[model samples]
Target: MKDASRRVRTEGITGAAVSAVMRDAGLTHGGFYKHFGSKEELLMESLSEAFQEIADRLAQVGEQSKPETAWKAIVKTYLSLEYCDHVEYGCPLPALAPEMARVDKAMKPRIFEELKKYRSRMLPFMPGRRTADKERAFFSIFSTMVGAIEIARMLPEPVMREKVLASARELLLRSF
Candidate 1:
């Protein structure tokens, strides 16, 4: 199951190729069926694990004493080279958001709940905004972070990678 999560995050959940990879890892194809009622269940579990990691990182930052500091930390961490490069082991927003939009209805609620938790953590730090405004800002922030990381991942060269991270850092830090 651990390996399944790792593999799915890194390679995506799909066809015979993934099955072959699992077999090579010495996990029988049937082993997965025994544990999960369906592939969607397995994906949900994997997403939960991924969400836990993001939540833990966010908790480590806490609600900063100065709201600006919180924003700085959020932008820096979310748009960093490390985050961009670690798609499989990192936030699912970049790796899974589009796919999740088309996934099982049950999976949608879990993802929304996880995102809600993140928004809750962030709300205290965003000042003078209505709930709707804050929610919009949160979504905007989330989108920018994910887009920056996605762009970083798409770059073909080391210098381009640095360029993306640096540009994202500059733009995002300004939001703080």
Candidate 2:
């Protein structure tokens, strides 16, 4: 499952070759079904694990620091070039969004549930007095973070990539 998570994040879920996935896992191609019932099932499980891992990391950051400091750390880490360069081991959202959009319809709700939990976990870190205001801020910060990383990763020039990350990080922090 961990191998699949890495593969699907670095390679798209449907784009990754099953044979390569098996090879990475040190198993024969035919051995796949011995573990998962189907490819979709494997993808779902992999995504779930990836999301849970990121959530745990964010939760740990929140627990270890003051809310404002934790929020800054999470944002800085999320927007860092190191995280952008290591999609296979980093957060799955930006890496998988395009592919996840086209995945089996049944898979989406499960992914959405995880996303909801993630946002709820992030809510306390955002600054807003009202629930609705905080919810809006959460979406804005979260979406900007994900979109900035995605756009930064797509840039061919290193300078342009850093500029995007720096700009988005500045804007997000200022908004809060």
Best by lDDT: 2
- Residue 172's lDDT within candidate 2 is 83
> How does model 2 score by TM-score?
0.87
Q: Write the per-residue lDDT of candidate 1 for residues 1-176, one digit (tens) a residue.
A: 45555566677655315465445345567876776676666666666767777766765664543654665676777777777777766777777777778877777787788777767876655433577776776777777777877778888876787788888788756653
Residue pairs in candidate 2 whose N, alpha carbon or C atoms collide under 3 angstroms: none
C-alpha TM-scores of all predictions: 0.77, 0.87
Worst 10 residues of 1 by lDDT: 15-24
Give me the candidate number with maximum TM-score: 2
Q: Write the per-residue lDDT of candidate 2 for residues 5-110, one digit (tens) a residue.
A: 7888889887888777667666675688887777777777778778877778777776787865777777887888877778898788899888888878888898
Q: What is the lDDT for 115 in model 1? A: 78
Off by over 4 Å in 2: 23-31
